[model samples]
Target: DAVYNILIDRWTKSSTPIHCIAHSLNPWYYSKEWINDVSGRVSPHKDMELSEERNKCLRRYFPDVKERRLVNQEFDRFSGGLDAFGSFDSLEDRWVLDPKAWWLVHGSSAPILQNLALKLLGQPCSSSCCERNWSTYSFIHSMRRNKISPKRAEDLVFLHTNLRLLSRNDADYKQRESKLWDIGGDAFDSFDNGAGVLEIASLSHDEPTMETMLFTDDED
Candidate 1:
């Protein structure tokens, strides 16, 4: 978040509402890194998982990311040990991460850190507004595996993200909808309603529910 504030202080200029809003929704650093009294220390290197020092310089290959710092050696080493070197232990890394899978989704970064940065990134404190509906978001992914055609997978995820994964119910829809309006006004507001059509919505306080009309042109 500190980095977000620093960057926003210099890069972002608009204050008329649209460009002024931030939208960051991910884990933080201190929280995840502070496990079992470790207090932000890297996971203990058991020396048992040191398959080998084979992945020592994966970061050197990172294109835009500079040689910021060293990495942990004991963590999982799937993608050529990409994570074995990052310092998700720091708040700065959470605020401005690149296009890597684990960092945004998993990694050690905490929610508080990313939440703070989301404020500075001018985005929102949400991951809900990120998607659309549920039923239409059909994909064949499983924790057991994720193998599918790139094209169909893209469409499924696209549907999943814009229609389902982001917000599948009501209260979330409203909250995210408001944030969208803050960023892009009616344009974005009309695009995502958890339902295809725009209309009045309501839900119970406990659940993320909303009532909207579903359509089927074939019925005509």
Candidate 2:
């Protein structure tokens, strides 16, 4: 409870109206008061009113007059009844559906909010996946085979990563491979004929060295 209070205090201090608006769109958090405590730290109704005010401020800069009108109409619909915007009868069911997909399919009445939800919800909060991809790139473009052209290296990396992702399911893997072959039959044939040996050599050297294993604490 002490840690939660500290965290919430920091979060509330740093938070903007945009953050509040995003939280309001999320079904799970929609019913939650701005501050979920009995103590008078924040007023939930006042916070909601502020969020709506911020939303209005955000809408003022719309360059397109037609879009502005559409947004206002959507807001009217949303204010009238939250349930009127989506097909789902219950918020519980909406919680199970992908938030972006739900907004895209069901937010026709609230186009501006839908677009905002899609943008906000789809944002990546961390660069961990990008860092991992860079690690993979280092393995693919090792010091020895650094002669590989940037374009060819990119294509190889794309194929390698996507093929690995598809490998879990045999049928899907084969289907994707067949589709790739159909699209770039000549390129694949050329790669097989010319770069097969070079690729194998690259993969051989790409294996983790003893030092790498020691640093990573990997026994195998």
Candidate 3:
């Protein structure tokens, strides 16, 4: 009972209307096999909490009454297995494809809901990515480098983050025996190879910098 209480507390704190809406739109929750395997519960559409949270999300996402009504209509069609959503191919693909891809293929009938689904479903449910960015930022602006200007630190963090991302996709990174990519350690550790940091820093000037693209809107 203690464990159940803890779980419920955590869930109550973390769960939001967006999370509820995402779960409501997820195809797997509607699968008989999945539903039976888990709780043998009613359909997600029938879940009172999910239904209420979905309505909350609808109000927040569509302030215009007409747009909200259209979205609600589309939601009804989706939940009821009407029209395109009712087809065999759509249900079959639900089991085979990921949420975003499934929506892309079958979501044409409900463009507004599809757009919302794509945006919400594509999001990560955790703060780990943001934490990693802050970790990188901290490493760059540590006591030893406290003199670094905010703009310079920001640029460095951007470069470091993108470099790690790019390297993970590189053929050489994939073939490495260690396979533990970040084993090199933190704070631009991946570049500890024979390649000098200064050499890579020089390349940033040669191409379009992240500063131009990331902060352009702020400049306006």
Stretches off by above 4 angstroms in model 1 are 1-43, 46-48, 51-153, 164-220
In the predicted model 3, the residue pairs found to clash are none
User: Residue 144 deviation, candidate 1, in Å?
Assistant: 26
Task: Give Cα-based local distance difference scores for all models.
Answer: 0.35, 0.56, 0.76
After TM-score superposition, the amount by which residue 56's alpha carbon in candidate 2 deviates from its true location, in angstroms, is: 9.3
Q: Across residues 11-86, which tens digit of lDDT does each residue of candidate 3 receive?
A: 9975789889999888777766666776648777999988998899889889999999999999898877789999
TM-scores, all candidates, are 0.20, 0.45, 0.69
The whole-model C-alpha lDDT of candidate 2 against the native structure comes to 0.56
Ranking by lDDT: 3, 2, 1
- Compared with the true structure, the alpha-carbon lDDT of candidate 3 equals 0.76
Model 3 error, position 133 (Å): 1.7
TM-score comparison, 1 vs 3, better candidate = 3
TM-score of 1: 0.20
Worst 10 residues of 1 by lDDT: 18-27
